[model samples]
Target chain A: MNINHVDLAGYLTKSLDADEHRQAEEHLATCAECRAEAESLQEWTMALEAVPEAMLLDGPPDDADLLLQRTLRQIRQESSGANRRRSTLVGIAAAVVVAAAVAGGAAVGRFTSPSDAPPVAQPPTAAVSSGPTAAPGTRTATAVDATTGARITVALTPAPGWIRVKAAVAGIPQGERCLLQVVDKSGKVTLAGSWLVSEAGADDGTTLDGSALVPLDQVGSVRVVTEGGKQYTSVSL
Target chain B: MPGFRLQRRREVADEALVRSLFAEHGRAMLAYATQLTRDRAAAEDVVQEALVRAWRHPESLVNGKGSVRGWLLTVIRNIVTDQIRARNARAPEVRESPVDVPSDEDHAEQVVNAMVVVDALSQLSTEHREVLEQLYLQGCTVTEAAKALGIPPGTVKSRSFYALRALREIKSLSPAGTERSAS
Candidate 1:
């Protein structure tokens, strides 16, 4: 429904009367943007409800200064308390719960999202090709194996405990099994991802996402190698 | 030297996240907990637990999905629910209002949705926010919000529509927002 008739605010907030509510419900089912807006606005109210009257009435309780100190002290110790509550109702993150994102990445060229709420679907390989404008804090490197003339470009995005490795490998022979490895400073190798090079993948190349358990502090490089352990190419971070 | 600097930066960023969040939203969190439990000491405990959660999942803050304050508030609400359920379990006879049965699944979902909503709401104008807070948070009807907000009822109805439409555009749903830009 257009703005003229639908009271979305009233509809989402349940402020609409019975007849209005029924009409709005039918309208929302067909209207994608309105539905999305209703969902977010509904969640916003839940967030706003958490706001204590005291916060708007004035500032925090005067005693809250001590609360911050106590909080810091808790962190210094075990920093443990009530466990994580649960996932959000939208839990739309479930939509991308790609069980084998590596295969999906190689087969369809979709980058595996490191974030829980990843974008709808981003063409990450294109993003890496245009590396001059990668998101701040992301690092990119390119390496070419002179022997095989194989080329690989890697974009490394750091996360909490691991690194998101997006590697585009071109010139590898078709039907060759490959493993994506993250090499840390100490020479420790963690398998961030693995994929089979398809015909299309071997010809035009394929971009896939992998992860390395090593922290950003210790990451040394990203490498693509055969199942036989022969390195196709390696790019130092 | 760069490695050392990078490590140092990461460490400081983590600590700064917690301190900055507390500095910005600590008071409001405490107020919310106090409102929920109606016990000052217990409220402080709830806020502390929520802060700890925020610290551990610092990714939750920088993910660009939602405001950290919104996540904190949701966590606070979840913790209070669990606390009430736990207390009621200990002494079922002591509860004045019936204890809410807690579900771990519901807790997680509320936190995530609230974060997304809070993030999208951040993009709305103050007028949009006010209209939402009235009709949604206070459960005020168009007429009631008009009286409370000193605007015409027709204005309240129209404002709510526009506000919801704006929030809709800001949210990146699976289907994606319509062509309209919230800005």
Candidate 2:
């Protein structure tokens, strides 16, 4: 009977009466099409349940232009083709991982799985080792940008809501306006602080202690970039 | 590297996609972020960061099968969760506590499924969408939803049956289709 189509949706959503449910199951046992559909509906409903609570709201406030402008300005500044390429991640990771090892700062490697052994003095692809190395919460990253010939290393020590940033920055020209920023797992940049390189600092590199509002667990990397948004160096944590 | 012109074209196309996405979903994204952070300035920062992510990974938006708004909302939720986690990770007492990071697959599935369902809901005929929105989103019982919609309970049941079927035809049209829809 076409009766199945009439009640199948109710059955799929579990809104069926006891009798209706029993009858629908009886039909589903015989009808492949109804059974297949019921199976699919099960997934969709579960997905529906997983929808986050925040989607219920209508939208942003009426006055949102300033926020939009800030966002657009950020995108425009970082839109350069060289930095936009995804290779920047791998490049930053490789350089910082190597530098971390040289600085004897913290555990560093490109292999993402946390279970992979500590980075060893082997090729970049080497991953035959065991569990991750020693370090409770602190991590350090080191990087040198070829384009700008700048050297920077940042070590992060996690606090509860913030982090302690100990960074050694060098090789940038004197009086260059540079900002020290912390980036999270999703590429959100939080301005930690900024400094203008002095002649002595450029030659000897300045090591400064600072703090960032980012959490310890989310710190993906730290970077020193010019006031114009050109990154001098970025090292992954 | 691609030719200068080709790269420029891709960037422009990407920019357009981001702008449209903002035009369509920005208010909603900001609303969600503001509610989560409870601070206007911080919420703005969160929305900007989420938008940046969308701009960089437009592929996620294009390849996603759910409602684009749903996907964007999911990203906003994640960014907030990380911020909260960051705050918790450094507590002096529990500083070194083991954090059970949810697998990427877990959240991705949740986000994508919600996306699909949201998109599917939007594509539904008004009658179908109204019924589901009342029942699922508003958590109204069949009798209650029927009363609210000025329809009979039996009609609600029958409508839901067909609505579920119609939802099976979800086609995620965004990042390009977004432009047309916004117009």
Candidate 3:
């Protein structure tokens, strides 16, 4: 039998039957299109084998056996559930069961999160703000210290187990000493701390002065009060 | 045979089957799992999970026809994907601080491996690596790879063919390739 184009394609990929495969090979010997298809498949498979296995994982995890056991148990549980639910419609139910099995495997793959996401911009004021902490996902907040005529801009982020705070000054001295405090929304100071003047002013640029992951049970918002009492900044946690 | 003896025989058979699989492709499966997950720990997990998955879904192996290695890789990829999704969902947002650049000594081997593989794979198009990953490393059949990627199986096969050729050419260009090519 002559090989149809689809047959040639399928056969070339080992997705077709015996007669079709023979027809495809026979045609491929003469036909440029089919020949090219066969050649490409060979090359692709070779390149794939060339890929080093090391790129796949950072290091061997200790939890492999545990996860596998858990997954298998979960799979068995679901299989038993399905079997119990539809002991009557055996044929149709088999198809559903197979579909579910495939889906479960696929579900396991959706695990890799893209490692890179857009970086959140830190407002200069976040480093200097004297206001209560903003909500979770707030990017920037402004706080004005009327006493010192210093506008403290602050930014806060919920890092793992710690709230990160940054502040910038508008009119305050660049090297002024300050106390950074995390307080509840009710203005009750909880964790009070100090940071030396590593940076201030737009020209001074952003600096990694210091940060601590506060206990989760600590205050909700962060407030910065300059030792000189010249400027202050605060942001909600 | 007594009923209890018959049950014991079945258990022995199952154990033998598992052992045979471990002997046949354990290291290869481990390597493939490592590649897919990019974590040694996760790789081990993938291997274990794949084996468990294979045991649970023996029908997926298509009797004795399909490659056991390929089937295992598919299981590994699936498990890795699920883990990645869960990690992403629970990942906490944090300030953008520069990632601590590892000391050159820390990732030297990794860097070398990455460079070699990337150099070889980069010769092929994204489509080529992707198809190869799905078919070989990820352990999908041509049909399955095509279906997952929304391409024709023919395309997948063709892509695979060219990708391998390009890789061989690249390998030949490298010192390692020179040795293999001379063979």
Q: Pick the candidate with the highest DockQ.
A: 1
Order of the predicted models by TM-score, top scorer first: 2, 1, 3
For model 3, residues B1-183, the per-residue Cα lDDT tens digits are 343332332222223233334433454456655655556776666666676555444444433322334445445555655665454444445432223222221232222233244335534455665665666655678878888767887788767656665665655433443211111
Q: Which tens-of-lDDT digit does each residue in B6-64 have in candidate 2?
A: 33433343344445445435655775566566567887898889888876664454344
Instruction: For candidate 1, give the lDDT of residue A201.
Output: 73
For candidate 2, report its TM-score. 0.39
Give one digit per residue, the lDDT tens place, for model 3 in A1-237. Answer: 223454543553466678877766777788777576556545444444555543331222233445444544554454445543422211100000000001222211111111231111111010111112233332323333333333333444445666565544343344667676666535566434575655333223222333545642343445666665643544332
TM-score of each: 0.37, 0.39, 0.29
User: 1 or 3, which is superior by lDDT?
Assistant: 1
- What TM-score, to 2 decimal places, does chain A of model 1 have? 0.44
Roughly what TM-score does model 3 have, to 2 decimal places?
0.29
Per-residue lDDT of candidate 2, residues A1-237 (tens digit)? 444354765775567788888888888888888777677665555555554433432223357778777777777677763556653221122222211111122111121212232232111111111112312344544554545545566657667889989877766666889899999888899988899888667555667788999886677778898899788777555
Looking at model 3, give its docking quality level.
incorrect
Q: After superposition, how far is residue A2 of candidate 3 from its true place, in Å?
A: 19
**Taking the tens digit of each residue's C-alpha lDDT, what string does model 1 give over B1-183?**
643332332233334335545544555567667766667998899988987886665444434333344556667877876665566575567654443444432443343333344445445665675676666555567777787667888788778767766866777533243122232
